[model samples]
Target: MAILGTSYWNLIDVLKAGGDGIGDVVEALTQLTPFMKDANVITCNKGTKHVSSIRTGLPQVSWGALYQGIAQGKGDYTQVEDTTGFVEGLSAVDTRLLALKPAQAAKLRLMEGQGFLESMAQTMESAIWYSNVQLNGKQFHGLAPRYSALANGNVINGGGTGSDNASIWFVTHGDMQTSVITPENIAAGVQRDDKGEQRVMDGAGNPYYVKEELFTQHAGIAVKDWRYNARICNIDVSDVIAGTVNINALLRKAYYRLQGRRSYQMEKPGQVSPGRTVIYMNKTLAEALDAEGTNGRSGADNFIRLSPREIQGEEVQSWRGMPIRETDALLNTETRVS
Candidate 1:
């Protein structure tokens, strides 16, 4: 019914049945016996992986006693001699012990070479939309200016104060595209990309899945499509800035021209280039400058301060960079069949 005394085979059947539990496999291994001490006896069990593992638990027996079939002798024969045997003999024990090893555990050299190298090619993807957004370099989202429950007050169907409009900056490394989220874009591009299906939306007009929001700039948003060579590292960046930011500025300036308006906010300290939209980037600026493509590092959470010349000529760092490599993680015991 079961191979290797039904325990291992029964374990296999449980595994093959498309489900698993620790109790079953343990019971299987428990029923198996160890190998004989005779070197020859151990050799016989080495042929199959299943039988080899079973022999480890057996009581050790002497090589000559096992094969010669000696009877009780007095001086040393009145009873079995001082020689004690272990599970079928030392040979079987050795074979059984070897069976306990993982198929590749012994080949440490191979795992370090081909295995580790192949691992680097694999990509990990993460989502940025999970948290509050950042625009350009500042947090675009403050506390979600929640409106008190008014029976019905979510994303007011395009009625709030400039709440419906926002531009975003998305960052990710991929093929045919290094980044998405355009200066001309309004909401995230992927939002509301549901094809022919009515995607759900939240109270603030955000898509529950992010790819279903109905923002205008969603069209200009870029994405690294799923592909092989490019190695789909589809890391997502989903912070939104106002697309119509300049629109408000223009409206204010135009109102002044008509001699009837005032400004709400002061222009940022610097040469204000109105020609470039909020999200616009000059290739001159985006061009990477680094000896090994390391480029310049970026800061987050904290603001970088350009201290007075009296203190320092350079911009002082506000925070450290994110870790490029992770620390050693805890080792996981092999619980599943490879």
Candidate 2:
């Protein structure tokens, strides 16, 4: 069950793009639904003027946050490992010391989206992988940071002395990457196939048969839903990339997101502009504008911030009693006047 959080401002633009933009993401999750409980988490940028609205009935996890992840190069799709293992050829003292300091040092890089996902996966599955203990039989459990976690590639780590109890596990997915190396090393044993064929492991001290899914670890879900391991699914990369995938289906899924978010009655939670109106200004707008202006004069600007102040009290207010009003100019009243 994965909750995907993203910027809500992009959500409005997604809403404007005819409700289909988000449907794309929904379909992506839905296709994997058999294997996951997925939902999108849209973090709204309050600073952005556009209001967000649920366009589908699927559940959504929305919140307010600073929009930093939207910056370029923020989305990560890389796989990594930590120091929770016996150094293959390094001595115990050296390995333990090395585990204390991998890469000979550390260059902290803040992660987001998939990057965060991988980090968490590495941590979660690190012990299992480092020990070469096969959970189920297919995937090598690992750990990562957060946000999103799938599988990751595999690696090998072994040595008799310093690396005693050495083993290997299979890891998959790029999002399950991290580097929080634990000092203890798990030595389940070397990985092997059912037929007892030799296999290789990754640096995470995990191994695999070259395919992503872990045939055994995830077998229960796979058997029930068909997300089985080693199953080569030919999903149209272009379609997922275009986010214009099977429109009819995706839209229906998007509808789920739209409808589910409506349960909350927060004032702004349900806000959305009238796409078009026979009376450009609907009652809501007219009422709002009237309340602002009704106090003293005409036009939206007169009433919003400071009242006309009898026409000349403030630097911003012109003699209000006059007919021609510069009030509308105050629509962008970013500052205060007398």
Top candidate, metric TM-score: 2
The list of candidate 2 runs beyond 4 A from truth reads 1-235, 241-251, 257-338
Error of 2 at 246 (Å): 5.6
How many clashes would you count in candidate 1?
35
What is the model-wide C-alpha lDDT for candidate 2? 0.21
Task: Give per-residue CA lDDT, model 2, range 49-83, as digits (tens).
Answer: 11223222434344546863432222223222222
State in Å the error of residue 63, model 2.
Answer: 44
**Model 1: per-residue lDDT, tens digit, 18-75?**
3322121222211101000000111111111101111113344544744577444322
Report how far off residue 131 is in candidate 2 (Å).
18
User: Against the hidden reference, what TM-scores do the models get?
Assistant: 0.12, 0.16
Cα deviation at 303, candidate 2, in Å, is 29
> What is each predicted model's overall lDDT from 0 to 1?
0.19, 0.21
Clash numbers, per candidate: 35, 59
